[model samples]
Target: MIKLYIKQAFYQLRENRLISLVSIIGTALAICMIMVIVLVLEVRITDCVPEVNR
Candidate 1:
């Protein structure tokens, strides 16, 4: 069941605190980096004219 999976995940995270912290941070950083890259590409594609407001 989903509840059992959630409980097991929490137990593992608690048992491996350092690894959990690292994994959480790494996932967050990767998400942030991807967001930044997408934002940059969007800006470049949309802001073709210098005087236009987006």
Candidate 2:
């Protein structure tokens, strides 16, 4: 099942500390990149109304 596959993946990640660290860092970077893109889009498309801005 999916649980078994996830458990095996975790076991392998733990067995290789360097790979695990890189994986963690890469995931974090990806999340940060997504957030940055969202912020940029919001800034670019936001309404410029006085009430909304205030």
Candidate 3:
């Protein structure tokens, strides 16, 4: 089940501290980069004011 997977993950993290730290930091950075890219695209594609002509 999901609980078993989580328990195993914690055990691995505790067993390998350096690898766990690197992987956790890498995952966080990747997530932040993706979010920034999506937000930038959203701002560029949306219009704040009305356009009179096409």
Candidate 4:
């Protein structure tokens, strides 16, 4: 079953290389943007705390 699934995946990849590339690029960009936003929010939250309380 796994072998059959792999074969089908390869066939589709060969048949639609451009579509596959675009999908990968779009997913990567989305993940990168999400990480950047999360990191910025984390830094801002941490920086807002006053150091004298600690």
Cα-lDDT of candidate 3? 0.96
Q: Model 1: residues >4 Å from true position, as ranges?
A: 48-54
lDDT over C-alpha atoms for residue 49 of model 1? 73
Superposed model 3: Cα runs more than 4 Å off: 50-54
Per-residue CA lDDT of model 1 for 1-54, tens digit only, reads 999999999999999999999999999999999999999999888857787865
1-54 in candidate 3: lDDT tens per residue? 999999999999999999999999999999999999999999999886778456
Clash count of each predicted structure = 0, 0, 0, 0
lDDT string for model 4 (1-54, tens) is: 999999998998899999988988999999999999999999987867579577
lDDT of 3 at 11: 100
Per-residue error (Å), model 2, residue 17 = 1.1
Q: Highest TM-score, which number?
A: 1
Compute the lDDT of residue 1 as modeled in candidate 2: 100
Judge candidate 3 at residue 38 and give its lDDT: 100
Of the two candidates 2 and 3, the one with more favorable lDDT, higher being better, is: 3
lDDT score of residue 20 within candidate 2: 87
Q: lDDT per residue, candidate 2, 1-54, as tens digits?
A: 999999999898889989989989999999999999999999889886769845
* Winning candidate number (lDDT): 3
lDDT of 2 at 29: 100
Displacement of residue 30 (Cα, Å) in model 2 is 1.1
